[model samples]
Target: MSQRHVLQVFEQYQKARTSSCQTVAELANRPQNVETLQNAGVMSLLRPLLLDVVPTIQQTAALALGRLANFNDDLAEAVVKGDILPQLVYSLAEQNRFYKKAAAFVLRAVAKHSPHHAQAVVDCGALDTLVICLEDFDPGVKESAAWALGYIARHNAELSQAVVDAGAVPLLVLCIQEPEIALKRIAASTLSDISKHSSELAQTVVDAGSIAHLAQMILNPDEKLKRQVLSALSQIAKHSVDLAEMVVEAEIFPIVLTCLKDTDEYVKKNTATLIREIAKHTPELAQLIVNAGGIAAVIDCIGSCKGNIRLPGIMMLGYVAAHTENLAMAVIVSKGVPQLAICLADEPEHHIKAASAWALGQIGRHTPDHARAVALANVLPRLLSLYMDAESSEDLQVKAKKALKNILQKCTHLPALEPLLHDAPPNILKHVVGQFSKVLPHDSKARRLFVTSGGLKKIQEISAEPGSLLQEYINTINNCYPEEIVRYYSPGFSQTLLERVDQYQPVI
Candidate 1:
């Protein structure tokens, strides 16, 4: 049928317009037909109906516009260009519960498309209206309004601050305290969006006292709600030390540790992220995690999760070990070293391997025991390989190189150090040779292995300036061996000597 026929359907009597609007909404629900419906000017037909006299026709028209806008950014911008938001925002306050719900959904649909579209909604003065809708007695209206606010706030810092400036936080806190699970999830999620943009905005969220209430939802059996709640807490906690401590002060440490063992991966992932944010700040906070037995739980998380899901746990391990020697020891005692080693060696993604390598560096950098723990896990070779691999990303390569140097400098384990002599770059080789220099002069056993493993041969081939540290280290290692052994291992030692002997004229 022509566009005229579609319009005729809505142009009929009140009952016919209501039926037509509902029919278009249902048809627009299918992804395949949204284009066909839009090409027919379905939006233009539905725009005017948003202000229809009859309640059902008005709300249904709003619902249809929402579905059309929900399909794509183009359609959403069409809704914006078609001048639909102002009517919806205007309707949001004056309409009944159902109409308010439908209008708020339309605003949400439009705002979700882009920052431009969301800004359009904000520019139309939707935020204050949406904030007011949060107070509606009907849970559905409140839920729709909360979702719209989240979409608008999620784009950037300025828009997020605008949502905060419009006074949405306290009412959002109120929504989380409501009995509805859906309401709680969206409210928590919206709060996360608002708080994620800046420390000031996050402080606004914290000052509203959302953490204690969010923490109380931890034991709820709903995985979806738990994800949002954890996300909100993580966002708020990620902003500043005081904010993170506020989350800690709520005593979710033990609960979050237990959550690491939860069957749901999202809960586990978000749980790991929340811990990571807290563990990142200070030694005292890291100690708080250690005292709560967090390292073992995170180790288990790293072991059980595959791919990117393991990322946060890997990062948490790094951040904790980054703080202090005692904290690094806590990670070592929990057997985090081997787990990180396994990730660096086995993970298919370079980013994950980089994260693992970084964490292992943190664990190994503090002291000899920490370094030995990493070296003994057999992680040094894999780190060197990643640094040497041409396919590795620069980020991965840099992290791997850093990790190798860290572990190598403190490592006295001669067996591990011996192999690194053959391949480690000049920068890393210095540390490897430095270790051998420190240890070989004092021990005969390492000197023997140094020759038997061809480590002496590898050292002789390295081209360093006469007075360079690498040459100095090579000279030190050569001194540990007998003079005859050093002479035999020197590069082209026989060929140069034979030519010199043939050209000798000292007697003449």
Candidate 2:
């Protein structure tokens, strides 16, 4: 690792080139030694060894350069600038499986740092060699080649299209069906990376018959494989309704729901995310999950996980509830509001809390029973508090305000609203006062309390613009009371005194 130690590894007569190369590779494997080895100009030494007459020496030198590059971007660029990639790519077609694996690894390590480095590998014609390597008798070379292509494709749409042009998708699909779990996991992940960039890219993967092959792995006992498989499905399903329908047609549900209960948190998270993507497309698609009991399973997933893990499940509930009143009721009936309420109240993250508030509004905005369900869960007051908090981000404030406006317009429960009058800003107060105007006029007891509890006085205190809707609401409430009480509650005096005259009696 030290400069002195690196020189000793290359003392050509003291140790065979193979032994020296292997020593450096092993030492570089320890992350702490990577920088020291690089600073000693080990890249300069490893450059020639990449083409050594002994194949193992070439393999180990590539392995050492890869370990150094894998440590950070600087070394990755060093590999690119060291002129090692052309040799590595050149050797891929000719080397034995072990040498090919090490060379492919060097490319993957170099490429993973950034698109610039990946593009450098492609400029040297690594893709054609890698694509051919995909068919090699050795599965190790195939897996390594797959990883390099995946890393290249991940950086941008142009690069992903490039990988597609090289015809990696069908081969990747083949890798997905292979017997090795690691190969399946990486293959699935690469498909996800490839499909995520654009609809065209996703359609390419689908055309390769990836959906059924991927669907078969949904319940695979390997948690890591299941995560990638779910993630890949989520990516493909995200592009369009037709694509989502194709995923659904696989009959992978009910069983996909079982993944929601997986012990691996990522599997659970990705499962929820996959369901979220599908349900977002259509009411009928959402209904599939509901029929499969997705609502209860997702709520349990939300309840069991925390932080970002809960986000997709929370949104799954929102998407389902957002589709229709019946679906919303399904969420409510499944005890979703309290879980959402808990997220809104307790989660430290603003975005998750914002999601919870928005979902609650969707659930509550439908009808009085729905609004009452949200009300009973103590959700509105908390939503109001989030809206009023100055520290909340503008996005959070916007979502909270929209949720409030939507829910309060449908809310008929008055006790839940009384506290809002003191705290709501002018915009929200209009809804609260309007709810009061609707109820107090019909219930004598509420009308009496509106006066006795100083509710009328609170209405009088609001500085509503003369012709605004708030002023109109005040006039309507004044008609509910005797003219004297109306005049007494008026801010100063009122032309509305005559507006209230219908309630007056025995006037001269």
Candidate 3:
């Protein structure tokens, strides 16, 4: 078949396939005919047909090529490597909304398949054309253009820089401010992608003072827009620490806190995750979280949230507890212990359980009083019970044992330590003994616990015949705690403990 003849056949097929009267079922059964045309180099020959088609045919051709984009790279390459790109660019200048959207879809496919094609599209002035589509009266066209620009910016840095140079930021910022939630979402996402490659663009976004507007969107009546804003903030926070600080300083915490109560699981989950990222970098912001009454909101989420939200919430609270002693105390005072304890009790997800255990340890570390508070909450007994339960996995058992050890260590001064020491279950005692023996000299409190509690007596009894227990305990103490703590009180105590351990090789 001649190239010209094949092109004619492809055009005929294209005309037949695009008719609104033609059923998709009819097109589906005609693969043989389609293959005959394709085998005759139809895609290669149809490049010119792309340029001459009316808006309807151009749209039809663009949609067909988008579908064929994944199936055959040759057709996609032909479309992009040929004058079809200029035609697509020209289509964007048209007033017809459908043609503009179709043109944007084709550009998206081209950008997805080939970075070179994306560059080519950009060189064809596609960026300026698409940016104008942001103002198009048709929302669908705006959405398609926003999506296409996002992909283009993600794949091509120069194109992204060009988009930023073309004043795309203000337009995108306007899109984010749009009353239409969907358009705002796509615009925010596109802005996020642009910001990743160009910090200048991120600064541009920040300069537009979009953070406050974004925070308002988080409280928007549309739940979908709230989610989009939260997600965008997460992305922005990842790139710019200044923007992150601004997010906190803007008092966006309350908005995010409210999102925790949203009925949509995705909204709550994303809000929790955003809160975690925000809290992790700016530990000082944990106080802001507390000030906004986020603790109760986050704690409330633990009961009904799925693992997605629950784990991050657990992790964030743990982060807060670790950073701020006062916040940790407040969490305990606000009854956060019971919620976390119950989550550990009822939620079987390992990561969730791990986070809970970690948060409990943080609480234990912050204040001995708070540690005793959790112990009094009865979480220790349940954690200890994990050791004996046949259903518990080894990982869960380890976490449970670790948390129990922290609880015990913290509560050593509390009266509850007496019962835990004497009436405590056997497995609990074994874990405590194992932990005590492993205590490093740097861990003064643990060393202190070993010395103050009956750990010293237990070591003495075990080492009575050989004295190896004393050496092992001494060696562990010298190695584990921080150098500063050891230096402050012990001086060369670390070396002395190791020397004593080395001198005697008695077996326990």
User: Best-fitting candidate, measured by TM-score?
Assistant: 1
Candidate 3 residue lDDT tens string, 1-508: 8999999998887677456312322332354444554455545544444454466665655665554443445546766666677777876787488778877887877776667767877888888899899888888888888888887777656777777776777878888876777888888777767766545666777787777777777877777777777776776665555766877777786767878889988788778877876776666677777888888888888777766578878887887887767878978877888888878887877667767877887787655687777877777767766755667777777777777776766563433443344434554554444444443334666566655555443333332223444454444544554556444344456687789899988989
Q: How accurate is candidate 3 locally (lDDT)?
A: 0.69
Alpha carbon lDDT at 422, candidate 2 = 78
Determine which window of 10 residues in candidate 2 has minimal summed lDDT. Answer: 9-18
TM-score of each: 0.93, 0.90, 0.68
- For each candidate, the alpha-carbon lDDT, in order, equals 0.91, 0.89, 0.69
Q: In angstroms, how far off is 151's CA in candidate 3? A: 3.0
Off by more than 4 A, model 3: 1-17, 20-49, 68-87, 109-125, 153-166, 195-201, 238-241, 253-255, 342-349, 374-431, 434-508
> Would you list the clashing residue pairs of candidate 1?
none
Best prediction by lDDT: 1
lDDT value, candidate 1, whole model: 0.91
lDDT of 2 by residue, 362-427 (tens): 899898888889988887778889998999988789999999998899888877877787788989
For model 1, the run of ten residues with the poorest summed lDDT: 9-18
**Candidate 2 whole-model C-alpha lDDT, 0 to 1:** 0.89
